[model samples]
Target chain A: MAGKPGRKFQLNEKQLGYAMVAPALVLILLVVIWPIMLSGWNSLFDYRLNDPTKSERIMTESLNLEEYADNRYLVEQGVNELSEAYPEGEETFNETWTVVQNHHEELVAEDAMASSYQEVNSMLNDYEPITDDNLRIQSIDGSWGSDFEAAMDEQIEAVTAVQQQADGDTAVEIGYLAAQLENLQGSVLSSNFVGLQNYADYLLDGRTWTALTNTTFFTIVSVGAELIIGLGVALLINRTFKGRGIVRASVLVPWAIPTAVAAMMWSYLFDGQSGVVAHYMAAVGLISDPGALLTTASGSMFSIIFADVWKTTPYMALLLLAGLQTIPNTQYEAAEVDGAGRVQKFFFVTLPLLKSAILVALLFRTLDAFRVFDLIYVLTGGGPANATESISVFAYKALFEQQNFGAGSALSVIVFVCVAIISFIFVKLLGSDLFPERAKK
Target chain B: MLKNQAGIRFYIFLAIFVFLVMFPFIWIFLTSLKPQNELTSFAWFTSNATLESYASAITTRPLFRYMLNSFVVSGLTTVLSLLIASFTAYAVTRLPIRGKTLILGLVLASSMFPPIAILSPIFNFVTDTGLRNSYIGLVIPYITISLPLAIWILATFFQKIPWELEESAKLDGATPFQTYRQIILPLATPGIFTTAILVFVAAWNEYLFALAINTADAWRTIPVGISFYQSEYTVPWGDISAATVIVTIPIVILVLIFQRRIVSGLTSGSVKE
Candidate 1:
């Protein structure tokens, strides 16, 4: 399939190498690196999806033209009716109407978007939804927007005072007008930008601290257990035996299962009422009762760690088995010649030689355990008072359930920082173990 | 005599380990096969086991559809990431590429980034681009996420290939691309195949992106679909277990068949040859 390349037209090897590698690097930058940077930037603001005022990443005071136009129309109609119905408060109605009309003109002039106002108003009249964000929202001067709000509040207060002096339908009409005036004031949208405030708030938040603690505890305990058990299993599987292939394949079964499915499987086994594992645990007196396994906080933490260990120890064993196989038999023979006991041989020969593999495996497992979401999510759902909530789950709830993007982004950055720190420590500990030639230089 | 005793102890220990590892699946299989009325009882075996749960699981939700979606997403991710990673692995291993160490380190570092950290921005971007429930949306991130490991495994495999063959090909007036396409690719097929299975398993099991990006019921992958099996009141353990068994059987079979290749691929970079 290769066409003949002209000698003068061909790219050099170095350029070709870069050309081949560029697509992957670009994809990583686009999908991974760029998104992380975007999350970091988003963490600086007070953004939310549920709150209309704080929804957009606004830097300046603005006016929501849709709300403004809708409320302005109601106020105009109510004020017209109020003046006609309440002859005694005609002067007050005219004064309030003038103040409202003047403020609307000032807001339009200050924002320099009279066209947007006209468009939104006509759309409202035609009963068409204002879907275009730019046409429905516009920036205005900060101080002027606040002053207009205060003026509207004062007018509403004056109208309320006059309405109190009237009776029956006349007072009812003025009250409705005053309420519309209040809504009109709410259309002045202020900026939601709060630099580092979300991070600051999370730093002070108890739930955030709890989430961090749960994540760290989960990572440490689970990875530690996996290391010990996985090493043992690795040594067992590494030995020469019949059907070793079958054993190795069976070991991968727990790992090969999708994590979400594993969580579901474990949840059934740990089910409070009907779970066999729970029933057996209670029978053996490892837990107080069969139902307590998932219902209690400590039990949940224990259950999750247990399931994680089960699911991932196989992976850890596989990695360590690879490392164990790398050790030549001569080293053990040398140990034997030195009259070393079994324990001494393991501590001296095996553990020493398997350090790199252990580090690599630990690095993968610890990072994985730290970022755990699906297992905890499907099994416990960070439930029973949110005691089992990992930072990832907490972040998921904030981003998706609460629709608080800014707070969620902050939590995401925290997770990134923790992962970075963990990786840095592991790499430092692994120093040159991973790349010996580069380290030698 | 002492050696024989130690061997006996090792076998016993191995048996226990295998039992502990496989018990969860066995228990789930039993649960799936039990009739719905017997699900609440903690029986090791049922008197009347049936395929009722499997029937219910299939009817209650589009389990086959979810499987198909997972296959499409994971399959595309595997093929695309393998193609991209092989080129990268080839470049870093065979060519006189500058910054090879830095490139390898970057690849390793990319894998270390927490997937949650990038979730929000990617979700927003996907939603903004109107690709929230599309295959390409999920496949793109899956490829990016799987690339690092695929590259690492493929690089290790590429390094093990003899350099003399490439030199000989160069002497025979074959261009580098031609040699890579005609010779290197054919030889690296086993490594590529192993990486494909690993990446496919990973993509199939991935939950977060699938949960976030493909919330549409028609586009749900197996993991997300299984997670949504719960109704408003009752938790249907029977149906869930049945679905779990159906989805997990193929993966277990693949892992069993390719045990040696998968192990070698996993351990390749962890140790020096």
Candidate 2:
């Protein structure tokens, strides 16, 4: 609207707003929303990098042409030697070899499979590896895939029967051919996609429930502790005091430490043998034994909650402190003049006034604590028996350590749903004004 | 007069509080300085102190390289997030954009989306695009996640900034870009500084993405680097403590120097809401 009155070539305010919002929205889409949507989509498949057949998210059955070609050559040589060794079983060997050869030719006769077959065969002949998954992997009909597999199985069975009936070198060579034929059959890939099956499997998985419970327990315990202690610290620091700045900064040292590094520090302090905290706690009768902290399930949970509380209390306090600062001195003064004690004034004035800050801080800390990863990871590595593994850690193990992307992404989606629910409860039920525009206006 | 009687008690409580908070740092420092043989010994004070752990913390690994990597990744994340979030915050706060509240809410909600939920897809994308183990790879997601905080903090600050100055500048024939560049940015320095510090700290401290994306030692940051100290069968407590101290020094310095800004930055949005 202002463009008409503005200098030439200068955009209007709305246009400028769009321009400003572009990069961040684009970034958020690409780096945040896009990735989440991708994970959600990926969770529908049975994808795992460790298993070659299920390494990719497949919508259609495909052939691994390089593998097919390599195994085909081996099958041919193996069957030929079997025929030479057992002249009596030559008919059986020829029949098995012809069936495999015919199937290979039939598979290549398909338009999509043909080009991939040629390319993969040429690459193999040149002793070059297939780098492109698409080029090396060709699509096939679902029925054809099942039929081919059944056909290969029959050939393998026939060859095995012949080997059983024969003697000496004949038996051994026929056995070798049968094994090679089976390996060739193994190269045929089907659609890896099993929509929503990963989610269903994990939903029924005990480990998933254990991780969810662990995450819930960690979030509840740690955030609850942080809130109470943080409120106390906030009140303490809010008062006029000597060296207040130093105290404030010192308290933040735990929060300011990189989470992984803080976990490292705590792991040291919780170290059974050399840890001073463990020693002191034992001496103080806080623990029955010094060495039992990190090794036991409940104890490891307590240790992580303790470490998380120590690291995050300052953050909670900082938020609460700002909230505390906003409350006018006159409110407290009025309460005091009315014969209200400290306890009365706090409950009637401070807590009611500080609700928004408490809600916001609790929401943030709960979400963060629920997603606890680096701290638990560096400290316990999800422990002696995975008693302390959070959902994030569980997802990490599934995705990276075990290369089960489908299950990992499913776990990831579960975390997202939990976080979304927590946020909804906070924003809608508790009436926390996360965006204060309407209230402010 | 009544407040004065509680003064001694308050100081005593404060001393206890400070001690509780500072003990871990003090112990780690002491442990870092202690020799290997003295580590398991049950002495409150070490009579012998050596810098041998610190020496190995640097010598036995490319600790300096990790520091540089952290610096590059965090520094870039800070600058980029600050630059972009400031514009977005300014637009959301000052412009006549419809659904400003919705935009703010979306940003806040995105920040709360669990990092693990997003990590798998990000890992796959980074792996596919061949951005793995590179600063850009790490910086991209760092910027995305940190943007919400930066935007929230900056919006709060920008809302407080008087718009009259911008109006006068526009009347004086300054283009929108010039007014923003010359006047708005300079005035928003404190807010920018606060956002920068928060973003930098978050980026520097991030572990999951750094751990997932970078397999190479060269691309690893301090947190990821310190985690590697666990690889050896014998847990080298001394070297780990030393590395912990080293990894924490920069953040400690930042907190010390900008304590007020950092506190205000952290507390502003939550308090304002």
Candidate 3:
């Protein structure tokens, strides 16, 4: 109904540009930046999936009402039975029972905990499980929670002392009562926050150092080999040759294969009993036996480096080849006229001209190799005495396999820091190559 | 005579290099074709090559289902990322956007983020949202991971387009969106196609997130599915090799067909003019 169609709806160019970019910015912030911040926060806690007390990310002292109600019920019943059966210890039993009741009453009377307590108690009475975490756990006063825990501990000690002095059924009843008190004490879940303790502990840990060393070694050796071989191949392929397209396509095969599948393929090729590569290596005296490739520490390291070089050399070659093609033939002709030999042409012209390309390629491959996971993971699973464990694999095992989220998050943050440092160094070395237009300005 | 000899040497070296590069594929192919009994043999050839391994891999596991899941996830990621990246690329290249260089630099920097660094929070998020085993959960993260390169490549392509054409379009009373949709999108098709192939391949081959988020048998992708092929007692080498060959053949063909496009896309900004 507007006079001009779409005029009212059309945004100005600047606004349109920002509008267009908003979706991607929001998505990247949500999925990438936000998760990283969350991981950093998670690393501060002593979080673990297997440990009930430290399962959730808690900032305050809380109580597991489900656990509390169940244990409290049993402790009340046991205390009542103990006082009825043993008249001489009736006073001790009464005192402990009153202490437990008083602590329970005080916890239930708190405004923050009253609703959760009633809900959990009703759930228990109705023979229903307290499955919802928010309803089953409530944050309480920290000092009061700890005080109650200390009181329960005291009662447990007193009951154990009575058990030690008693005989027959009285001793068993007192011991059972003491265990119920211990259970009740455990229901008070304390904050799992440990600040930088995980990082501090990992700094002193040997496995962390080993993983770092292995990752660096792999990055250096594998990337070094790939650079040398990739440069040679790039020079060779950059020539005007017959069937160049076919050759180039074939060269990309290894690069195209998924790293995980390539790892599987190499695992088969390195199989001790049936592997062709292993058999040939042993026959040629490259190794003492075919079986050692995946089993021995040195051989496992060699195998990964070899596979990485094979897998990535094509990519390196392609990157360098792009750089190579950009160098006009006139430069080489001028060099030839100046009496520069083939070796001189390569050293003087090629390497210098290829500097940016090599740096870019190296930056990409180094960061990639440093974060190497699927290839090493599928090939060796960082096995043979953890000889081949990369930091990524270590973090993965800690996070997923062991479910030690706090330690795993710490490892993840460390990976992020190392990657950031590597990128910083490369960017510094790269100078203005990364932003040439801006550099000119 | 000397030149001829040098040419012969070069050809020989080329031959050897190509052979070395292709040897793994050849070896894996041969392994895939070998009968179950000859799988472990070190022989270069097997007289009894058969399709039994392929048959077994297909029948014993949901190989096609895994392929379908991978295709869906990769396809969705490619489309969504290409859409988002193109819009961002257009804005950065054409519009009077502030901090254009900084935005581009940030995009490049983000691509360097190690995937494992953010795996924990994303894993917890996916599990909490009940999206762990679904395609959308996997695609969301995949798009984020692929966006940096996609935007970079598209920006490069968009920058190469002449500014005169856009000015003319504006003079013709074409709105900015019309010029973008009608002129820019059409010209940038090849770049978009190149980015699609790269993004699709990346999502298809992603193992860690797929392994972690979609552990359910019904939702497993190709790489994760092949990883679970071993039955604790004996390694199913034949079946695995066959499945790998099956999965790899299409990707190989795709790379071969778009070899030039891929190379250009990969090295677009590496060597600045």
Show pairs that collide, candidate 1.
none
List clashing residue pairs in candidate 3: none
| Cα lDDT for residue B261, candidate 3 | 88
Candidate 3 lands at a TM-score of 0.90
Worst 10 residues of 2 chain A by lDDT: A432-441
Report the Cα lDDT for candidate 2: 0.85
Provide chain B TM-scores across all predictions: 0.96, 0.94, 0.95
Residue B7 in model 2: shift from native, Å?
1.1
lDDT of 3 by residue, A72-124 (tens): 89988987888888777778888998998888787777776777787788889
Assess each model's interface with DockQ, reporting 2 decimals per model. 0.57, 0.62, 0.53
Q: Tell me the spans in candidate 1 whose CA falls farther than 4 Å from its real position.
A: A1-8, A64-138, A151-187, A436-441, B1-6
Clashes per prediction? Answer: 0, 0, 0
Question: Candidate 2 has which clashing residue pairs, if any?
Answer: none
| Candidate 1 chain B weakest ten by summed lDDT | B1-10
| Most TM-score-accurate candidate | 2
RMSD of 1: 4.0
